[model samples]
Structure formats: structure tokens, C-alpha cells
Target: MNDIAPQVARRVLLLDGAMGTMIQSHHLDEEAYRWQGITAEGSSEILNLTRPEVIAQIHRSYLEAGADIIETNTFCANRINLLEYGLEDHVDIINRRACRIAREEARDRAYVAGVMGPTNHALSLASKLEDPAFRRFDFNDFHASYLEQALLLIEGGVDLFLIETVFDTLVAKSAIIAALDAMERLSVHVPIMVSVTFSDASRRTLSGQSLASFIETMAPFPLFSLGLNCSTGPEEMIDLIQEMSETSPF
Candidate 1:
């Protein structure tokens, strides 16, 4: 574990709240959101460039508000997500710049956890109805895209990586694999935290895998922590969290 990860177990760390809510408070128009025609609406990652001052201000606000960890505003900086805005070519720089901005603001005051969102697209789905088991992007394709983003994030000086808001197991597996590969290739190890979204009271993912099963599937990877996020209120998640605490290794 990184210095920060150990403390997570021993103490309560306050993470900053939603990034979009903070950004929306700025009232930035389309020009600011687009940042020179490189990003589309609903994609906040580009704020790191066009409105970096805004991003920095938000980070400072969270830190002032007593957040222990500030995540980079690069949730969609990966190749898979960036492709939605025609940003496939700028993947490396986008992620690096976002992490750099957060690192500067954090400045040893807090940990900068790189935020990697689940890429909702599927690779193993076919275009034609004739074959259902076809793939537009295979496992290697998913691995390479995630590896590229992870490398840049590490180079940009994040204290750790947070694979968050994950709904699909396949994509989560790909991200975990890519992160491991990135650490090996870069020769730098950082603690990784995995968070999955719950479908409902069942404590299963949208794909219908139980929390215990999710843990089982992800057991091969060394994760600093694994828990739930999104699609549920506290009343629904309490039992699930308790279940994970009793079942999970980390």
C-alpha cells in the first residue's frame, strides 16, 4: 500500500464529493467545456486544460472543506471513453495534464487518486445479428486502452489509482489487468482501489453477479480496497457494505 492506503484502514479519509456538481457551480459555458473544440458537453475531463484554474479552484475548495483525497478530473480520459468525443488521439496528454494539475494542488497535502471510470462500451458484441459472440474490441483491445491511460496517470504523479463507478465485470477486469501491466511496465507500484455499483437490494452488479462473486472474480488482482458506489441509497448499501466487510480480504 502507498502511505495513503494504509491510513484508509486505520482512519477515516474524507474524499471530495461529486466532481460534476463542483464544476457545474462554475457556470462555465460551452466554450469552456469544449476547451478548443476537443471535448463535448457532459465530458468534464477537458476542464483540466481549458479551465484549469476552475479545476484547481475546485480541488482547493475540497481540501479546504477537509477532504483527505482529491481525485483528478480525468474520469473519462481513457481511450475508450475519450473516443466518445473524438479524443482518442489525445488520451495520453489529457490524462497526464489532469493528474499533473491535481498533483500540484495536492502538493503532499493530500493524495491524488487518478479516477478511471468504467468504459461502458462492449468489445465482444457483434455488429451483425448473424453472430452474437462477435467482438468489435477484444480483451487485448480493452487492455491496451486502459494501459495507455494508466501509464500516463502514474507518470503524472498520482499517489494511487481509483477504478470507480464500475458496472461491468468484464470492463473492470480489463482495467485491473491493464493497471497491473502499467505498474509492471513503468516499474512503479501504487495502491489500487476498486468500486462497483449495485443494481439493487440484491447486492449484485447490473450484470447480476453478487458482491461475493465479484470479489471472487477480482481476487486474482491485488486491490487496496473494494466496495460499492452509485445506484443506491445508504439504506440499501448498509447491508452490502457489511457483507463485503465480512467477506472481502481488503
Candidate 2:
């Protein structure tokens, strides 16, 4: 992974677009995502171990297209989310290998961003709008899951961490805390980039926080960057990006 701070200081950095989108373009079937008699068809993360060349090719394509940062193929590789595919036990291998694939493909041409996505569940009360009090996992549970994944990403040699597709601020908070803790324990320091996803065109997270509120909540974290991703396209995001620039210190 290259030094990202200097690059950020110089000019605008082009982070690669959707990993899921690029993977989908390949049209991999169920067999492609399977390994050791375990078939996790929709789990793209499985390809990091089963079909690394597929992931490496995607990274290469983005780099060739002039992307500055190559995000890993570990979006849903966390233990909690992988449980859905009965892959709870392969979390470490999945995350570490994903990073390795991205890093090898990136070489010194681009940075490898360890992508940490929000899990299938959320800790925010409003996640269950009808039952605002319901909770599938608490902050501690989320923190632990992120911590385990973060540690492996670090060990796998990512240049930085990208907590992306965040629909819940609480989930983002947990991920940030877990990343910090993982760095401390591993004696490493890496920049953290966060990209929040609006639930809709409302410019608010699914947890029901406005962009302003989200900025205020995440203000204390030492984030490398805080901005928007997912939910909408450029036309809809223009105003939101302008608004974020005005309110966010990052």
C-alpha cells in the first residue's frame, strides 16, 4: 500500500467505484463462489479464497482506469454477516486473503483500502422503525465483530481502512472504535476513510439522521475522509456533497 496522506494532500484522489458492480459484470455463477463443498453463491468475498484471479483482475481494471485507491473484496466478510452463509468460521481467512489480493494487484500504483461494510443488522434504534426499541446486536457486539475483521485486514497488509456503505451511524461508530482498537493492539497506524450511504433521496441515513447530524456525531473520530456513497447517483448527490463540504471538517 502506498502512503495515502501525501497523495490526499496533493490533489483529489479517485477512489475506485463499486466492487460489487465490477464483480457482477463477470457474471460468476454459484460454482464460482463455492469452496470445500460449501456453496455461498451470493457471497463475493468467497472468491478471494476460491477465485482470487477474478478479484485481482477487477483491481487491475480499476487501476488501469486510473483509480487511486483499490478497495478490498471483503465488504461482507465480517463474522456476523458471514454467519448467514454458515461461513462464520472463515472470517479471518476471507478478510486477510481479500486484502492480499487487492494489495498484490495494486502493487505500488495504488493504495489498498480494507473495505468494512455495515453488517446485515444495525444497533441504531430506528433501524426497526415500527419497533424503535428493537435491537439485534448491541454496540459491543458490533465493535467486537469489526475488531476481529480489522485485525485481519491490518495483518493482510491494507494501506488504509474504508468503512463504507454505512446506513447507520451507530454501526459506523462501532467500526471506527474497533479499527482504532485493532491498530492499537497491532502496533500499526492506518488512516480511516468513511463513506455514509443515505437511505434514500431524503439525504438522511436509515437510522434517521440528517447529513448535518451524521457529521456532528462522527466529528470526534480521526477520519481520513468523510463523505457520501451509495443510495443515489451523482445528479442527486451534488447538493449533498456541497452540503457536506460546508459542514464537515474532514
Question: TM-scores across all candidates?
Answer: 0.91, 0.96
Who wins the TM-score comparison?
A: 2
For candidate 1, the TM-score is: 0.91
Angstrom error of the Cα, residue 105, model 2: value is 0.7
RMSD of each candidate?
2.3, 1.5
Q: Write the per-residue lDDT of candidate 2 for residues 1-250, one digit (tens) a residue.
A: 4578987889988988888888899998888978888999999899999889999999998899999899999999898899989899999889888988888888888889999998889877544778888887889989999999999999999999999988888889999999999999999898999998887877788879899999999999999899888867888989999999998999
Give the Cα RMSD of candidate 2. 1.5
- Candidate 2 colliding pairs: none
Clash number for every model?
0, 0
* Model 2: residue 27 alpha-carbon error in angstroms: 1.4
| lDDT comparing candidate 1 with the true structure | 0.83
lDDT per residue (tens digit) for residues 167-233 in model 1? 7788888888888889999898888999988877667777678888888888888998887777587
